[model samples]
Target: MNPAKVALVTALAGGLSIGAALLGERWIDPEGGGIPLAGLGQGEPVQWPEIRLPDLAGHEHSSDTWSGHPLILNFWAAWCPPCLEELPRLERFAQRHADAGIRVVAIAVDRPEATRAFLAAHPVDLTILLAELETITLTRRLGNRVEGLPFTVAFDARGRHVFSHLGALEQDQFEQLAARLDAPSATPR
Candidate 1:
C-alpha cells in the first residue's frame, strides 16, 4: 500500500471513531453525572412549570409572580400529619429569612372547604396558596411529578429547582439546602 493512502485511511478512521464517540455521549447518559439528588452536591437548575392557585381566603395567585425570589413550595393537604407540623416550622423559616430574598410558597392541595377550616384553626404564617384545578394543571407540568402530599420543591432566585423532597422534612434538611442556596457563585452548582 502507498504511504499517502495508508495515512489518509488512518485519518478517516480516526475521524469516524471520534464522531461515533461524540454521538454516543450526546444521546446516552453524558458523562454519568445525571444521578438523583442523593448527594448534597449542587444539581442542575430545575425549571419549574408555571403554576397558579388561590389563597385560603379565595384570591387568584400565579407562581410566576414569585420569581426573582427563592421559593420554597410545600405540597400539602390540611389533614396531612407531617404537613401540620411542617407549617409552623416553615412559617418560622420564612420569617427568619424574609430579608434574605427567600419566599416560602405553601401550596395546599385539598378541597377549599377543608383548607379553609384547617387554616382557620392552624393559621399558617407563610404565604399559603390553594391548589384548584389550575393547580392540578401546573403541578402536572412541573419537572417533578406529584405522587402525594408533603412534596417539597425548592427553587432558586431564577425559578430553577434546587432540590425536591418527598415526605416530611426536618429542619436540618432545609438548613443544608439553604446553605447551598446561599453559596457563592464560584462554587460548583
Candidate 2:
C-alpha cells in the first residue's frame, strides 16, 4: 500500500470517529447544555423514594427527613471533580437559606470511608448522606438519565419535584432554582 493512501484512510477514520461522538452527545443532550436527558420527571409530583441511607456517622435516616421544607438533593461522589467543585456553592446556598427553611442535602454515591475522608479535609455546611450500590437507581428515579455526577433535584415544601439538573449547578442555574424554591408548593392530589 502507498504511504499517501494509508494516511488518507487513517484521517478518514479519525474524522468519522469524531463525528460519531458529537452526534451521540447531541442525541443524549439535545440542548447542548448541562441539562440531562429530558422527560424523566419535571414539574411533576414525584414521590421521593423510601430508602434509609446513612450519615457519615452511620445513623440511618429516611429520605423524608427534611419533609415539609423546600429540599435540594444533590447526588455526588468524592472522586468526581465536578461534584467537588459545586460543594462550596451548595454549602453557601444552604447556609444562606437556613432561615428560609430550604434544605440542601448531598447524597454521596460513594463508600462511607471515602466520604468521611473527603469531608474531613473539606468541611461543608450541607447535610451529607451516604449511599451504597443503589445510588444509580435512586438517582435515575430522581431524573438523572445519564446517571452522572453532580445531579441535583429540587423539591417544593410539599415534596413535589420541581426541578432537576444533570451537571454541576452553576451560579445562574442556582439562581433559577432558588426562584423555584420560592414557588408555591403543588396542591396535594
Candidate 3:
C-alpha cells in the first residue's frame, strides 16, 4: 500500500473513533461519567423509594425510619472531592436543625469499608447510610440525572420530593430550604 493511502486510512479511523465517543457521551451517558442514561428521571416528583441500606455498624435501616419528617438525602462517595468538601457544612446544618424535625441523611455511594474509614477520619453528625451498588439507581430515581456526587434531594414530611440539587450546597441554601420547610403553608399537618 502507498504511504499516503495508509495515512489517510489511519486518520479516518481516528476521526471515527472520536466521533463515536462523543456521540456515546451525548446520547447514552449524558452525565459524562460512564453510567448509561444517568439522570433519566430528573426534575420529577418521585416518592422516596423503599430503601434498606446499612450503616457503619452493619445494621440495616429502612427509609421509613425518617418518615413523617422533612428529610434531606445527600448522595455522596468517599472518592468524590465535592462530597468531602460539603460534609462539614451539611453536618453543621443537621446539628442546627435537629430540633426542627428535619432529618439529614448522607447516603454513601461507596464501599462500606471506604465510607467507614472516611467517617472515622472526619466524623459528622449526619446519619450515614451505605449503598454501594444501588447508589446510581437510587439517585437517578431521586432526580439526579448526572449521577454525580454531592447530589441532594429534599422531601416533605409526607415523603414527597420537593427539591433537588446536583452540586455542593452552601449553608445559605440549606437555610433557605429549611425555612421553606418551616413555613406555615409548607409544614405538614
lDDT (Cα, tens digit) per residue for candidate 3, span 19-67: 4455434334343432222233446556767888888898898888988
Global lDDT of each candidate:
0.65, 0.73, 0.75
Per-residue CA lDDT of model 1 for 1-189, tens digit only, reads: 669746854664465456445533332223443312412224654475576677866787887787777777887777666778777777877887788777788888877888888888877678888776666455434422334446677777766666665456777666765676665641224
Off by over 4 Å in 2: 1-38, 41-44, 185-189
Candidate 1 ranges with C-alpha deviation above 4 Å: 1-45, 134-137, 140-146, 186-189
Which residue pairs collide, candidate 1? 46-161
Model 3 misplaced stretches (Cα beyond 4 Å): 1-44
- Whichever of 1 and 2 has more TM-score, that candidate is 2
Provide the lowest-lDDT 10-residue window in model 1: 33-42
Highest lDDT against the true fold, candidate: 3
Better structure of 1 and 2 per lDDT: 2
